[model samples]
Target: MPAKSVANAKGHSAGFMNFIREQGVVGLAVGLAIGTAAGDTVKQLVGAFIDPLVQLIVGSQAGLKAAEFTLKVGDREGVFAWGAFVSSLITLLAVAFVVYAIVHLMKLDKLDKSKDK
Candidate 1:
């Protein structure tokens, strides 16, 4: 390879590394991984406990995760599965609560205030 081409390539690589560091990509990646795991854990928690209680109210044998209402319009039929939507909403709420608890417990929210000074 030409010397000039090699130098340019090296400079580009170094710039990319600097961008990653300055943008906090490593911390974002770690937070993403932890958030994914925490979401799954919260979903499981909801499925295990909350779903059954909701099922009793919805009265679906398949439970809240499978609840749906059927709709028909002039012989055309479709089911509006609000149950699944509700289930997803539950998952989102649970994940938010779990994340909030973790952030509160770890005092991670204080970091923002410190940075403001």
Candidate 2:
């Protein structure tokens, strides 16, 4: 019984390793790290470059220069930070474009390979 259990465990471990190998673990890890770094870089760019450009276009009061606005709700008043939302939207668009470009390139490469064969 003990020997059978040991063999089963070994088989399970081997299967798991085979699954990782088929999925290209090294490539997956490198891509994930690079993508995360790129996202952070984009966020910074939106905050630094896009924010100022937007502020210049919309004026100091309506744009990035004014980070928040006051809203009145009956007897209560609240502040809304719209600049952060603008920055976040810019970052999202940048990341989407990057991913789209990558996928487009990959599809082109695949087509080229099929043509060669």
Candidate 3:
């Protein structure tokens, strides 16, 4: 390889590293990964435990996820899956609560760099 090309590549590499550090890209990436895992965990918990309880209360023979209402109008039929929506909403709330709890308990919010005036 030419010396000039090698130097340019090194400069680009250094610039990229500096960008990552200055922008907190690594921390953002780690947070995203952990958040995804946490969301999945909460979904599983809701699906396995909370969903069944909801199903029992809703009295859906097909389970909460499959529970829906069918509306017939003339020759048209519309199915409204309210149960699925409720289940998803529950999952979202659970994930948000879990993330909030973790951040609060661990004081992770304090680690952020203060904004410049």
Top candidate by TM-score: 1
**TM-score per candidate, chains pooled:** 0.65, 0.56, 0.63
- What is the per-residue lDDT of model 1 for residues 1-117, given as tens digits with 9 covering 90 to 100? 999999999999999999999999998999999879877877787678766666676676356667789889998999888878887776577567767887899998877664546
Note the clash tally of each candidate: 0, 0, 0
Q: Model 1, 32: alpha-carbon shift in Å?
A: 1.3
lDDT of each: 0.79, 0.72, 0.80
RMSD of 2: 5.1
lDDT of 2 by residue, 29-98 (tens): 9889987987787667666766566556656635453588999999999999988677567657756765
Worst 10 residues of 2 by lDDT: 108-117
TM-score of 1: 0.65
Clashing pairs in 2: none
